[model samples]
Target: MAVDDFKAYIRKIIHVDMDAFYASVEQLDDPNLRYLPIAVGGSSKRGVVAAASYEARKYGVKSAMSGRLAAKLCPDLVFVKPRFERYQEISKRIRDIFFEYTALVEPLSLDEAYLDVTVNRKKAPSATLLAKEIRQKIREKTGLNASAGISINKFLAKIASDINKPNGQKTIAPDEVLGFLETLDVRKFYGVGKVTKDKMYQLGIFTGADLKSKSLDELQQHFGKSGAFYYQVVRGIHLSEVKTERQRKSVGAERTFNDNISSEIYMISRLEAIAEELEKRLKKHGLAGKTITLKIKYSDFSVQTRSKTLGLFIASKELILEESKALLYQERLKNSVRLLGISLHKLNSEQNSSELSAKEAAAASRKHEQLRLPF
Candidate 1:
């Protein structure tokens, strides 16, 4: 095909997401938690839910909601602490699954990713089939179900993927794309969060069709910068690129013990090791974070977490260990500890600095080794 004709041909984009990622991992690892109302996060007064299983969703539990509120809503809700290392490992496997088809893959988190398989290694003509295969591979390898959405662009593909979640697949072909957008709720449009949704409702924009009626200038006048994006989306036009180089916001290390531990001294020692490892990573990246969080899992599958916001970005081993240790001290572990984790958050400036330093260090190390006699 000629370059122009190829560009005109319908593109295939797939959005794949693991169902209830953290909670699902807990369920997969523990037979008792399978098919149960599970939450992956802390279940304390000062805690929040990181992820919740489908069963727990029925009881009004949600991510970022207070754990106490979730327990009140669902008395039987099982809270399992986050095992970030396990999640990272599974994420790597999922990414590997995507690469089997196309190298144009973008990971949004440890549980969700996007792939542009316009020209795949398998030479499969249908994006739908490729998505189905990827989901299947993820399940077979990780023992988890993933939802997929296939469309021509990232916006529609991401929306379609969530339509049929928890081991479901859906596609929006070019011919049906407009009709699909017309019927979609305004809130479902990318970037239309709670505040924007409320503003659109006030203007009688309940559906994509309603939004399509407004001129670009009118939308811009109403929404400023975002209005242009809204104008484009209602008409099925989204130009955001599937980025391959978005720096990881944070890097962490964690572990889930085979047996639950209650000794504070033991837990502190383990946390100290994890923190040291994390600091090494931060230094290697030449990056730092302003927040440190400590995660704990209990024998009963209950979880507890605490975080501390530092006044300055921390990159040294001592600083990370100190913050992690302090956060752990703040949490009250009611049951035997099954897991522990340390994570750094809110990374921005450090990314560039870290990347440069890492490159320079690698170059220097290579030079030193090359100069040394290989006798």
Candidate 2:
């Protein structure tokens, strides 16, 4: 769409982001872990960091960095395995708090969400006040800190949320949008990644002010389709609304290697791990998918995906492994692989719910038996 065609909007949106969620949870569970450098996951050379504590981050440790490097960066970094079930429970508790204020909630991930509170359940006077209340409630109930950003739209709101670190809130008012954006570095704009930032610097577009000088056509000529996006957003013209219903078309999990591997044996082991994680997610969400896809990213960063659709929905780890293995061998490798992934598509929620019901029934029966036994 042309930049001129963008809609004009000034809706109140709030972005809530948890502070190092997985790492914070670990600290909350054990007080001794607080104030210490901690990383959740990536204990092995091949393992990757899932989350890092603030103390660990100070030493340049981060999620997606190799466990070995994280350990090297912070010699005292304590590594702990992730407990997805516990995280899910905490996520639910936080979401329940969101629903108390507004139904126009869109969860970006387990740790962050965008809320449209222009008109809300409690009739709050300002989005900033609501952000404070929501953050306070989250801390009180979950024993964790959340940072919030409030602004006229999702773009500004998301950027505002990050202005204050752990347990803080920032608001960008409607009238102040342009000025606020002008001072912001071009690199700080939501969608500008490392490569784009470098290109922007090379083109003398170092700040939002510099970027605003370029016409939509010039931006398009230099950056292709994303040019129009950068042109409008810098001028405070993002028109995306807060969508309450964001559906999951597919579920996937992948691992990025610190080094590429050509060994089929190592590849299968990685695929097995990916399939297991995908299976856990499928069961967690009560979803069964008929199509299974295998994604591969080579050392050069070139990516490829292969998928197969079955006649019926299935949510089994063994089956995921079997199908993904077939896809792995279906095509010859262009280069050594650096990442492997497995995804489930064409989901059937009703079938998945039945399977969850059976599992719940069996667990209840075991509990009943235990209660009946004399101690």
Candidate 3:
């Protein structure tokens, strides 16, 4: 509708998300399970769902939801533990396919990523065509389905990716940007959470149309720095670039157990295993951070996080295990814990991460080999 909307998105971006990634992998590995409602999370009273298959979603199951509730909603729901290693292997193949078209790939997780193909190795004329081809290659290479969204910018691409999911693709042309956004719910706008949506409703902003009607000053009066963001986003203005080399602020792993454990001894052993896994990730990524955070989720779904900042960057298994146990011991358990995680933050510069000592490299290899596979 306006010159501004068309000017900002000269670059083409695409977001690809694997449909029900972990759950889909589980189903692909076991054909008989494909017909059933599959939930790839934990199957315990305290477990949370990691991913829900299309069948599971029919009964209102979703990722990060409690497994107990999922079972309640779908009585015949089947649960399986996550296999991160297998997922990682598949992700590499998917990314390799992306590299064939463009070198600019930014991974959000093992299951989702954003790619900028404005200038590509293939020199494709249309981003939509690129997205379609990428999705096809991913399915062909991995035997897993992926969905893609093609747009001029990241914001639109991310939203469009969810339009027709499960091995589908959508594109938002420049002419239709404003109209497409106007019909979208304010709740669906990026960064507008449930709390923010409620606030928007109270302020009489129900959809993009409502959000667009508000003046920048009125928005600033309500949402602070984010107000300015909403002002630009409602009009399809996003300037963030697709970065090839992305830095992770944290690296950690957590697991949900089949049964809630109240024993301190068991928790210590589990924490050690988690610490070993974290060290392997840190070594693999060539990262070390100064702040170590321990996350605990209780049987009742309540979560707690305790963090400690050190004077030096540390990524060794022994140090992570030591600090995590210290934080764990400090907490007085009011409930049987179900999930535990350790993440590192305040990462050091990446310049020195690649230069691991011979001993350190050997230790990392051993850690990788000794990983306690959940599945």
Candidate 4:
């Protein structure tokens, strides 16, 4: 298809996210784990749960909760260590299914992805039907349940996906959006986190309806930048696009050590892995960054970060690691480090028009400077 025709066809978007991915994977691998309360992660004193099954969630178990607390909540809750390799394998399988319909796929994480299926191979007219079939395929192939959301844009599609639980699909047609959003909870709105929610509650904004009742000035007074987002979301005017190829502003990777360590060598080993991951992502995206940041989390949960800006943008993985390792040792850390992360910030975009213009101006200026011939 021609580029303009493809652009015209790219309108319908569907977001698909598996319900309790890690826990579901565990259940798929072992039938005994099915229908039983299970939390995937560690059950040790200091460990944390990565995913909690719906059955386990009934007892208040949740992801990121301390393993100690999860066990206390559900005494029989099974904790399984995460197998990222296996998860990635399944993720690839899931993505392959998306390719059967459209090539415009944006994966949010291993378990969730957005697909632009306005023009699909199957010639499916309704996005809802496509969502349902894709979900069914995922379940039949992997013995896992996936929830799908169909909408006119990425924002609505993301919201719709979570409306229904496992093995379900929800569609929000463009015309029904206003009423649909009015009754939605404030927490469900994208970008409204714990802090924003609390502030909105103070202003008597509990639901989308309440938020819509307020004027733009009223919202902006409480939430300077985020108030605009609230105003737009309440009006069902989400401008966020379904970007298949987006220039990442940052690339980062972080990992928690097996045991807390004060030794610099152990910390470096962890940093190496993080740097490697960041490098791989940078190479995959065909991008680079001018800033390198190093983050450290102590045993007591206290966190610290250091960053340095380079003169030139660099895409070399070796250079990223070299600069990151230097930043790690540049300062003397007093406490034992439990987690380490390496990130590349201030990423240079490969397709931004403004960046291209700036490059052109700089080249022209350099040419003028050379003509001056300063001795």
Candidate 5:
């Protein structure tokens, strides 16, 4: 196909990500916390840092780090308890700003989302300008800064959003997508974590250009299903739409012990408590699933998952606990375990034909559509 024909099929996508959301909110609510290194979560030995302020980040503090480690990284770091309700309230306000420009919004989490503005409520011709307007509105309304990335697809847009951190935006024109992706580092790819990056490095796939050199068969042989994904994304062929109503794939809850436990009897008790929490979450969402998965995280940080699919969906704590116990004994512990979790998959929502039909219809209406770019 000619370049013009290819550009005609390109869709405008903008990924908006809030900066250090949880910790930023803490600072927003307290004037004294501004410019100081602070983390939002418990500071106890067993507690984890939910979020860290930019000031803390300079000291190598980050979310999901243990509080003890975070404090060690930044000795003066202040730890504050999470206020989820307040964060949700602020998130809603930011989302409202997004809706003003386009209804094709897919929220990835409370802190970020993908917006499709190929056809927008404001009839805007420039996604770059739309992103600017959206970010400005968020700051004015919530007193928080957001970053954005604009491109022809979700993958590139998401990656671009992180280029200028905290409060900024970057635009990758349709004509620039291929060159931009080709030189990009493999480690910068959205789903490439540390383990995957290491594997890619070992395989000599250090950049998009290197990855693009591998044949499809070679990638599949090495990386299995994810190989196909890596192949397509490197060539800028991502086709995932910005879903307006993103479905929940799974619901789960987990607990990390203060100390590793080697006792099976004690582990079962902990699993039961986790099941209770998972049950409440499942019920809160009016969801049930046919598959139950038990996630075991060892003291060494190695993880294992065991799953069983039943004939029917279940959401009760009793059934969940029953299945978890069976799976817990399914395999002997490799070493002392530090965390146990219960998750439900193949949710009832995935089986909802009406929702699927609606999604299909919406996708059909936007098929092969192109946005009018201002550049």
Candidate 6:
């Protein structure tokens, strides 16, 4: 296909992300919490913030930061325990709104999703206006603020959503996609985390244009398989689709101790408790796996993972605990342990589900050649 013809096949993808979802829900339920620096998670010494309100963000408080550190950042920060059930209820209400327009909705989490509106039930001529309408409907139904980004594909759409955040939206037109990506900072690229950003800076790839200048071989030499991904995205050529049914790749549970424990005996007890929790989660989903992984986090914040694959799938508490104990003993502790987790992988559901691989999905997407949106 010619370049212009291929561009005509661009999909109308919109990434909708709720603004500080967990924290916002708390503030919405309690009038007093509004406009305050509030975090949704435990307030204990070992507690971690799951989400932070915009007010909290101003003080450098963010999700995953320890409760003690968050408190130090914002002395007046209110810590609210997470009510996951309530959040799930609101997420469903928002998802219902999404279905009213299109059935091609891919939820990233409780607070964010991607909607492919290239062929929507609403038959809306413009995805930009459709996104605005959807956000308005969400606010009316759930009393929550959502931001959206409309673009040709999922990657750009996801990135654009963050441009005007906390109840705003942005649309990147086909004509503007290349220029938009060219000047964008490498750090702002979706998959480029702090470590990758530093590496890219070291390689003098500070902008999308700089990334575009590198050959595929050079990118692969530096970034491994991800190099090909960066090379494609910088030119606005991502082809990932909005999958409606996402599979669970793993199930696990973990906890951080109030004080780091160094004793192997104590760690074994903690592992037993964690294994029981993992078993409950597995049974709740009627799932079992063949691979058992033990995750260890040291006091220095470094993490290590040990995994063992069995010939048979296991989900029972006894089996999980047994496997976890074996993996835990497989290696010696390097430092004082701050956290431990147990996860089940190579799940039975994965074997049963006929989900397409990334390559297959990309190839399938190419079969559809007429996705011309009015935009």
TM-score winner, 3 or 5: 5
Which tens-of-lDDT digit does each residue in 1-375 have in candidate 1?
Answer: 243432343457789988999998898899999989988885765567999999999999999887889999999998888888899898888887777786566678888887777656686777888788888888899999999998877998999988987789889886677789889998888678999899989999999889988888988998999998888666666766555546767778887665578988888888878888887788777778888788787878777778888789887878888777777777566888878988888874532211123443233223211111110
Q: Model 3 lDDT vs. the true structure?
A: 0.82
Total residue pair clashes for candidate 5: 0
lDDT of each: 0.78, 0.84, 0.82, 0.78, 0.88, 0.88
Model 5 — TM-score against the truth?
0.88
Per-residue lDDT tens digits for candidate 2, residues 46-145, read: 7889999999999999999989999999999999999988998999899989878876777888999998776667866677888999999999999999
The better candidate by TM-score, 2 or 6, is 6
Residue 106 of model 3 has an lDDT of: 74
Predicted structure 6: lDDT: 0.88
Give the least accurate 10-residue stretch of model 5, judged by summed lDDT: 351-360
Clashes of each: 1, 0, 0, 0, 0, 0
Q: Model 3, stretches more than 4 Å misplaced?
A: 1-5, 255-267, 298-302, 328-339, 349-375
The candidate 6 region of ten consecutive residues with least summed lDDT is 350-359
TM-score between candidate 1 and the true structure: 0.71
User: In candidate 6, which residue ranges exceed 4 Å CA deviation?
Assistant: 5-9, 350-373
Across 230-326, the per-residue lDDT of candidate 3 in tens digits comes to 9988888887877555666678888777778898789998998999999998898788999999999898979999999999999999999999989
lDDT (0-100) at residue 148 of candidate 2? 93
Model 2 steric clash total: 0
Q: What is the lDDT of residue 96 in candidate 1?
A: 79
Per-residue lDDT tens digits of candidate 6, residues 1-375? 267754754788899999999999999999999999999995988899999999999999999898999999999999999999899999988988887887677888999999888767787779999999999999999899999999989999999999999899999988888899999999999989999999999999999999999999999999999999998888778878787677899999998999999998998889889988898888888999999999999999999999999999999989998888888788788999999999999999832213324454444344455655556
Q: Any residue pairs clashing in model 1, and if so which?
A: 285-354
**Which candidate order results from sorting by TM-score in descending order?**
6, 5, 3, 2, 4, 1
lDDT (0-100) at residue 106 of candidate 4? 70
Model 3, position 101: C-alpha lDDT score: 79
Which segments of model 4 are wrong by more than 4 Å? 1-11, 43-45, 248-251, 257-290, 311-322, 346-375
The TM-scores of all predictions, comma-separated, are 0.71, 0.83, 0.85, 0.78, 0.88, 0.91
Candidate 4, residue 290: Cα displacement in angstroms equals 4.6
Better of 1 and 5 by TM-score: 5
